[model samples]
Target: CAMASLWMLLVCANAAAALLVCLYLWLIAWPRWKRETRARLKVADDATVVAFFHPFCASGGGGERVLWKMVHTLAQLHREKKRSLHVVIFAQKGPKTPEQILAGAEERFGIDVSTEGGSGGGGSMKIDFVFIETELIDLLHAETWPRFTMIGQSYGSMVVAWRGFQTATPDLYFDTTGAAFTLPLGKLCGARCAAYVHYPTISTDMLAMVYSRRPSYNHDSAIASSKLASLVKCVYYFLFAGLYGVAGAFANVVFVNSSWTRDHIEALWRLSPAPTVLYPPVNVEALA
Candidate 1:
């Protein structure tokens, strides 16, 4: 009778474990990972599609300056009558239209992106703007997730990122902003991924704060004081740190803002060639 009961207990435990695995795949893996991707951006077959993933391109911020600068630089290159090149930016549609966004870039940052799409900058260069629902883009904002801001933003980015891919897949994917979550999506789509990161999603400083149980703006005092809560959070961060590193490694090139960022990305990414430090170029003329 004792042996039979022990056998029954082992069987029940195995069944419970199998059920949990099934639930995880059904709720998490299949929806987020197993879906197919499709592109909606239309372009000529021969043209090289270079897409910039900047959801807030019209914000007129420093990052927008950098984004438009690159776009303008490409526009200049297009004027040279070079090979077929199309620059498509993935942005969240706001009250402003795409044309308005271009005009704002010119007016605010003195960077112009108002080029003829069909004429291809008088050669074979073209520019286009893409967008999704504003709500999806809002996921990137910290305010969207009161709890687990880092993980929430990261997961929300994947939604935005995957949605962009479902709209269009570019030959080369560039993220002007620090949305590293999108890197893996580009990788999955067989596009070369690049990033200009001001900061990483998970950094050593964040780890130290959680480790030391220090309450700050990001860390709540309640969790910091409770040892069990702190330990739980530490585990969450530890697992997320692994995911962050894995996503970063998918990028072909990573450009950090400073040497400090370079050190962190290097340790996390573990790439063969270290990430290059690319400072944001100041528009001295506009600033003046």
Candidate 2:
């Protein structure tokens, strides 16, 4: 058992070292990439940058509504403060141009987030789209990490978020896709990290499932039937839960989409005021 423990420790340590090496290489290129990205986008030096780390912001899903609404609201509020705001979206994959994405948002959500679209709502906020590589985005997908998916995707997200840092460093960052792993990355880049957590990466419900020895999507019959396997999964989930709590602690603010989400986030993260329940922006009037 002691030797088994040592082997596991070595594996985890090496994986962590690999991630660190990637981060180091990314940091080495960051300053040069930042300057180049800023110049290419024509971003002013003094503008407050709010980066939304949603690789699929232009997808126009429920999350996209929230994304566009936040863009509009933040733009409007900053205009009232007389501060120049630059909203940069780290889109997962983009063949569409920024104008095309903005047009899609307006067409789908009826929200005009364009600074130059002459929507009367377009204020002092300028918009830029930073398209991330498709391969990097796929790292967050479940198929990429079939075994130990929770931890796999958590570390995978850190890599994808690093790609965003290689583009432009923002004053503020919102990991709108529930990538809690990226919160620390944002903080490391000197940005005030924020998250709109739709669901926790590891939840107490998942823990309970493993405890009850239930076979479900996350756990197959083989693991559920074997007592030893269930015990191993329990330990994995417990350790992950602890690590997730630590990662979540780095967020400057957390906004959840529902009361259930709020309960889980609070239980895990234990924030001072608790994570605020900022439900997704849905257009009821438009539907009617």
Candidate 3:
């Protein structure tokens, strides 16, 4: 037990040293990453179809609403043009199966939601549902997935790393947070990448709030419960910023889901690309 404890201490010490070194490197290279990424931004072609990456977590939340709405809206647009749009819903499955997630989406998004001719949209578009738990690299290596535009929300966006595993590029990439600048979606997906950010991950204001320097929490209890966690998260982010730096720098375009999120994305990243506002849409007319 003593030897095990000693080994654990050594492991922790090594981790701390590595983290410190990485943090220093991130600080020194942050400016360069920003400059190089910005210089490469230019408008891309629109011929490529948009593939919205849907992780479809069983929790039917706002992000899923946004995705379903987007899919429906795009389908409506395509139907009007008498053309079809291609989409791929990328997800990871574990105890919560994809069928369960799909059922949840149906329950929330609509009962008619299916990969087939559902959602009141006709079979004009060929929709394929790929249920794979393989790494993004394996998906790329398999060469079975159709080259379509990629859009991801939350966890789905994280899979953009799969693009890096393959030589193919997406026509367009869009995500609402949980993407955190990995895999250079724009470059790797071979499309214009745009994301709807939910928050500024590494902003001074966030750090302040995290450090319990905010005005709201005067007691140590609040600090210990929440602010301290935020501070610790910020520290982790600081050390790991480089992991996502390349992805952020290589984004062709970006959009924030809310004003609050946009501010944070800008402040924390040190460079804010021309961000567009896309308020979450509601199906009011349908209800009416």
On residues 49-124, what C-alpha lDDT tens digit does candidate 1 reach at each position?
A: 7889998988978888888888887777776766557787888977887778889899988776776546344563
Off by over 4 Å in 3: 1-49, 82-84, 94-106, 111-123, 134-160, 163-169, 183-186, 210-246, 270-272, 285-288
**Model 3 steric clash pairs:** 51-149, 51-151, 53-151, 169-189, 169-190, 170-189, 170-190, 171-191, 200-264, 200-265
TM-score between candidate 1 and the true structure: 0.81
Distance (Å) between predicted and true CA of 69, model 2? 0.6
Flag regions of model 2 displaced more than 4 Å: 1-40, 117-124, 271-273
Highest TM-score scorer? 2
In candidate 3, what are the lDDT values of residues 1-288, reduced to their tens digit?
Answer: 999999999999999998786565345443343233223322122223454444443456777787766666666665565544554454444466545665676677673334454322344333334344655424333134332112112124445444321222235555543465543534443456666565544454544554554544322344446766556554654554433444565655666677876666565554437666778766575788
List per-candidate RMSD values in Å: 6.1, 4.5, 12.9
lDDT of 1 at 47: 62
TM-score, cand. 2: 0.84
Model 2 agreement with the true structure over 1-288: per-residue lDDT tens digits:
999999999999999998896577557645466567668767666667789988888796898888899998887876675666778888877588888898999999999776773212224578877788898888888999889898888887888888878777777899888888888778777678888988888888998999999999888999999999999999999988888888888898889999999988888886423698998887888768
TM-scores of the models, in the order given? 0.81, 0.84, 0.55
Clashes of each: 1, 1, 10
Alpha carbon lDDT of residue 203, candidate 3?
A: 50
